[model samples]
Target: MANPDHEGDVGPQVAQREQRLSGLPQQVLYGVAYYAEYQPYDRLERDLDLMAAAELTVIRVGESVWSTWEPEDGRFELEWLHPVLDGAHARGIKVILGTPTYAMPPWLVRKYPEVTAERKTGVRIPYGHRQDGDYSNAAFRHYADRITRKVAGRYAPHPAVIGFQVDNEPGMELFHNRAAFQGFVDRLRHTYDDDPQRLNREWGLVYWSHRIARWDELWPPDGNTVPSYDLAWRRYQSQLTTDFIAAQAEIVRELARPDQFVTTCMALKRPAFDPRELNRSLDIAAVNPYYPMQDALTMPEPPPDAPQLEWETHSGVWAIHYQADLARAALRQPFLVTETNALSIGASHGNFPAFDGQWRQAAWALVARGARMIEYWHWHSIHYGHEQFWLGVLNHDGEPGRAYAEVQRIAAEFKQAGAAVVGLEPTADVALLYSRESKWAMEFHPPLATAAGAADRSSYERIFSRFYEGLFTAGVQTEILFAQDFDGTEHPVLIVPGLYVADDALLDRLAAYAHDGGHLVLSFRGGYADHEARPRTTKQPGRLFEAVGATYDEYTNLTAPVRCSGDFTGAATAWADALQPTTAETLAYYEHPHLGRWPAITTHEHGKGRVTYVGTLPDRELAVGLARWLRPNPDVFADRPKTVTVTSGRAPEGGLVRFVANWSWEQARLALPVAMTDVLNGTDLAFGEELHLGAWDVRVLLERPRKKDDEEGRPLA
Candidate 1:
């Protein structure tokens, strides 16, 4: 939806109209986020007849009011959302709309206070919250391109709108203003071409003296203490938030309508987010997963010193399927949850809604990970200002309670699993990878520490969520690659945890994906630094040290847990790596006596693949015994109960589905590992029978026949 030549590429005729979801409607779209300008009275025909008696199809609407769509500047009230999009297209819902430009209007911050935002260099950022200005200010992109072309030219031919969200969660504030630090010193004078000594020997900048001979003696990133100048000022503030959401998806694809569509909701812990270069200028991928509901979605988790939730939700249930496998790994297809947990999300002493069948077990675990749409994040409840108790789904007396009868039984089980689970596709044995420039060079040099010792800047999500919760507690099924979309013959078990800022062409493509047979793993501070966060002096895991047969210039940081013995036992917290194997084959060691002379895990082989490595940070029963020895084939509801989990995918005729759930409150059971069919109950079971489930249940099923030459229900890229 955005090829206006900002040159960040998305062309191919706008990627073939964003692979057609054009006016959506295949199913799985249950909804909310209907503001009706935060209704205090006059219920827009009782919120579109309780969103068509709760079998809602969609809603979204006016992204958090830019002062009720410009109450004063250029004075345009634009028919107050034309009776909420003509009463949500008279019942059969739909809508979406949204471009109120991340709430700025206090009279455009009292008439352009130099478009606010600074957070340090001059310290501005005063105006009341909501993305406090400076979206690369040129008078804030001329009033955010005149209210995003007057709200996409006043709701582009609204036959129940269809799509457009533009900006409501865009890289929240990395704008150290003064035109975002002179546009990061004119993008470092066109990325060092104006060579300030080749950006002083590629950012080593001769250390403390901070070299730089010109290019306006480059400085500002708030007193930067250089980690390759904070990973090139966090890759130029995530390329000014992917050039302000690809210039608002090229101003809503010049008034939308090639069947609408255009997105931007990703609040996936935004530190100047990237979302694979902002979903290459939007046309799909939307996020905001938000987790932690009741017993924090149980399942023997809640330990590593519980009491979490310090914002941007997510706590367990393998972090809600790792935020729906990171919103289906961004542009790797099927997405859109937009906002989640419609009730009790943040502040009001952080309430914790969802219990009776946990909103159908987190909407079938975000539709078994690929998620076509869930919506939430509202629909009544705002009785006044800063999210008054953030609870919605018709609360604060708007009526229909129990989170609107558990989102109307998950919108009648997504309308009886319509279109066999809309856009399924999710299936992965293990791939993981994910970097975001090694999470912005481990948030500028944090090699794990916190336990009060400081500097744990979530050390790359604590070493990639302990190997993605040990491949979701060894029921394995991951898929989140990134180093420019890695392949290794379509991931025959990749892993690669804290790949600390790699380069040498991604360590020669993970040593040629382990000399071509795959199964590469490697963990702890991988290939220790290269792509400008420097450090690779060519020894310690650098440049895949002989395909990781192992080497380590000593490492430490474990304030407690240490154990570890033979074939991968538990214990090995924080950080470690002292391994000195040579042609590798140690598979676990350190019971600690001078860290048992090295090895805490190792392996080799290399040509026709097999690398392994690890060297510490396992714990979680050594990441579920190294994800059940790197996925030793099982998962077809792998003997259930541990508060059951399952997952699976494919479905839209090519059939397979699965989902399962259970998340404990007791009654669990399992058995049937094949002959299926319940898809929200059209019953019929067989193959080994049983199944059951109950409390916080979920189910779904499908399976029998429909394989259509299944390459495991294709779609992984």
Candidate 2:
């Protein structure tokens, strides 16, 4: 039975119209996930009208509904999606079709019981929710390939389709199936050359009488006390997820048009796997930033007389900036926020919805940091679903609210200042090193509370975030560099935090970096273990001890805040270590009765540069002070107030776009670096003039727009 509305086929007129629409390049795209199948009302056209009114240029659909796409095995129902594409295209909106592999259909699962991922307890997870399918399962891969090809083939020729999201948050579930265990064994055999002795020796398996005699003698990593095997298991899981997404991307590429792209939404916060590896096969990096905006990155309170003092307060820009910067660093390019909040309700406990103008501030902050697109998680709230309470811009009643008003205002600004917001690259002189190896290693052997006297639960991300927050508060532009991506020659200042999993190669690189006139700041737990999480056999503090000129043979985890006073005065928490400086100078010491005179912070000069090793998790005040001491303000803004953060990028026109954002609730009056026009409001200002900003306000300034023929008009590589 052929559908009559198509008139034999989607004619050339529709194709030509879509091509014309595609010819006009947009500075940035904005929209939401349009789930027509899940909507209780039959008003998709009306919803499209609302989206058009809000200047939404894109809509993502058909990602999480596999049963609806194919009700039965080998029978696909793709016709239902035609209207969605047609409706969005009719309103000048492009669509991104998704491969429905994240969710599985009951018929397929009933036929292939092994397709589901098994929990670490060897119990197969029932398929009531998403991400239950096993990535390593052959049957799951077969169906994933079939369904991906079918959807991609059907939509590849559709002119309205702009891209394809391969899968929704892959690696969110950790699979411990039989296949994964065998895969782990194969990996171990390949790494150790089938030598059980080498594996046992490297992993220190002789302890606890856990030595393996043969390859088969090795069991799953469940309940394993050895860190090497545990680290290997995590690496294998990451590989599985990477391979799964790569397979679908390959399939989509084969069927997608040249203009179309293939990518996946990366969940960096979930900590299930590394997003860097998963993004290898993607076109552009897309991150989901549903951070606890109100409380994640704590900042000091404003003065009593500050503007909006009675209003609520939130953290600095570090939390979202860290995530987005890492996503951009993963791809080394401008990225997209595929999913952020509109109303921000649901399963997240104690989450406060956005205050008026807060949504606009957050959106513009992302754009200021090289994000080319910002799409809300959804358009309208679903009437019935597991996430029914996750409200959108439009509630279940389908009425626009304060969130929609904010989106509309932001859309107007984005349309007006297209060149200022787009094609700009975020650059930084400082880089923070992050790695999944360290995160997994720390999770396996967290700092014991008995040593600290307090039960400290700070994870690797939390500690890293604190350091980043320090730098952010200091108004230093920063970028995140993964361990694999770190290049010693690129960044002038490098900050390494709690790098629990260390190796000689990385330590050597850091030493060379410091010797070559680069500043290095390292925290506790750094250079303490190898890549496999085994303690280094050398003197305590591991391979880089010579560069740091310090050795900490003993450590303690604090049960309460321990006072530290000297050049640096503050309280330490979570963990502290006893430091014996070799050629280093002590900057601070513990003020405790028994632990007095022990170095709490040390600094060493190597070759032409410097290295600072913090022996304790310093408080926020000291953390901020350290960041400021490392990288002082540039000469252009040496006297700029600390309350205001300034980020600069090359404008599409041959000039710079400066984003001056006031992160505090109080008004910030800062001197302008140059005479410029505020692009956001078209106000011209003189150099050295004082500029005042209200609480949570952002100003985009353009520095003398250049002509199109100017050589510098081109973007920076």
Candidate 3:
């Protein structure tokens, strides 16, 4: 029966809306995954109201709706979906309809055994869990394409439809096998388009392994760690996945008569797969920051001073400064905080962990950092997974639990502050390229000693963790850019901390950036090798070191608390390397007891460029010193707002609001330069107004009115 509410799915434009995929409105988008199975129309409808009450502009319906969208092969079901889309639209929320393909129904997988790829041990598992489905399977790919095309073609012109989110988090379960490896090997043979010698040059094969002969001889390497041939092939496979999703999304756009934006949501912390790759493929790349949630119950202890996420699986950003820093840097477009927890995790004591005022501050902290879209991972707390995966922003009863109230209040206050700090980009003086390859390749494995120490679990991880903490305490705006990501003209101060393996081509770009009067910093293993992690194109310390006038004499892993007698912020009792500079100046000497007279820090000049190198990871105090030494007090402010100042991007809308957030439960008087109207309370501010910000209160200076526009007797331009 045609749904009475949807009005027979209306216009050609209405049909096009289903195919459309644009970002939500100007205000900060607060969203929750509108799970089809768990939430019926009424609940989905209510949550949609709460979502808007919280100022959410986008509603993401899960692809698990496949059973409803295309119940059986070749049959389409729009009766249930039409109302959901129509309901969200009626409430002024954009709908991001997911393509029904993440988890294939058991019926399809069972019927086509060819769908499940074999493991290295030759055991083929059926499509069972959420992460199942073989991307390489023709049948799987075909059906996914067909269903997605139908959704796109049918709904592309709908006004309420803003974007088409194709598939939910693909490539979850990976195949590290010879067959998948060989598939790519065959692909590589076809690379250079039939010139065999070029492959030898790149692969460095003296005698091409007999295991690799014709394209058919290839097999996807069946191992957790990629064998050489498979490493390059994995990139190809990643490309294939990108192309597959892109093709599906494109078809929907084409057939539906494109109107809005389109993309997919991604798990940012995936080890092998790159978020950059995901970002590259999508229009508005959404991220799941489940950093503290998955393992929150396992977190060691409450920090004496601060509150951290529960179980931080990927420790670096989850716990450290890189957490928000990456969000500001990764994508140029407005980003989304697609996941968080209102209730934290369930404790071993048989109760759900609750959020305090601190959790509320942290959520705002994400907003201050430029999260255009924020959603608690799940709406209702559940009794599953040992209470480990804390996805709920509300309790099971859907009542105003502790976190629920906090999220509601903050979102409500922000709603009154229209487009205040929504679209702001990350502006930073310090550039720390957070390389995917560095995080994945240099993190840890057998043979290679991590950050330092023989028996240490993961030295590099430890160093990265400590470095991020140090940088945060130092209070500098830092960005994570990859060596591959550095555009020719980068920021003024570029700091490359650990196992850097940029190819010569990339090194030349870095040199040019340095040559263009920018400052560069290197420490420990800088310019160590090429992409393959081999001896590198130009040898130890690579070619750029010479340009920076530095040479790496040795790389030694020492435990921290590095002690030096000189005037250092704090001693570096341990370090990872002892570098020597040629025709350069030594900033800090490695005179520590164990360091034994090697250079731990140095500075040099090449062309118009300046380079600084740190041989060891120092304490936070010294890191502050180094940060000061890089760009110094110029970025420092005289008139301070609240400790938490928010800069946003939604400029077309009036006023950029900076929330001087004072969360210590203490009153704060903050000095301001520009006068602003409080979007939340509608209070007006005068220049140099001292804010009597109450404890746990956010005194937001709504829109900083422009002097030029004010002088012209018009609304600030």
RMSD of each: 20.1, 8.1, 7.7
Q: Which pairs, if any, clash in model 2?
A: 451-557, 452-557, 452-558, 452-559, 453-558, 453-559, 454-558, 454-559
Per-residue lDDT for 1-717 in model 2, tens only? 111131111456335324423422457777888898888868988899999999988888999988988899999899899999999989889888888999999998899988888887478987788789997899899999999999999888987888888888778777888887898899889999989999989888889999989999997767778888878888888889889888898898888776777778887755457877887666777887765443322234333432221111223456667777888876666677888878765463433566565677778778877787788888988888688877777877899888888888888888888756785677675878887888887777776453535433346766787788777766677877778655464567888998888778888888888898888889988889988898888876788889899997898877677878767666777778888999999888888886675788899998888888988887777777777777734536557666566776665456677777766566778887567788877888876789888876678888765467755343321
What TM-score do all the candidates reach, one by one? 0.40, 0.90, 0.82
Per-residue C-alpha lDDT of model 3 across residues 608-662, encoded as one tens digit per residue: 8877777777755666567666753353233443233333323435445454554
Count of clashes, each model: 1, 8, 56
Q: Residue 628 deviation, candidate 3, in Å?
A: 2.9
Question: Where's the lowest-lDDT run of ten residues in candidate 3?
Answer: 1-10
How accurate locally, in lDDT, is each candidate?
A: 0.80, 0.77, 0.58
lDDT of 2: 0.77
Per-residue lDDT, model 2, residue 141, is 95
Task: Name the better of 1 and 2 by TM-score.
Answer: 2
Candidate 1 local lDDT, 1-717, one digit each (tens): 011122123568565555536668778898888887778788899778988888788888887787777788888787888988888788888888888787788887787788888878888988877888878888888888888899888888888888888888888778787777887877787877877898888887787788978878777877788888888788888888888888988888888777788888887788887787888767678888787777767885764553356674348888877877777776767788878887677788777787788877888888888788888888788888888888878778888988888898889888877888887878788678788888888877889888888897778877888789878877788878567655344557788888888778867877887787777888877878888888888898888878888898888988989999899788898778888988988988888889888888898988888889897888888889879888846666667778888878886568768888888789999897557778777898877799888987888887776355654432221
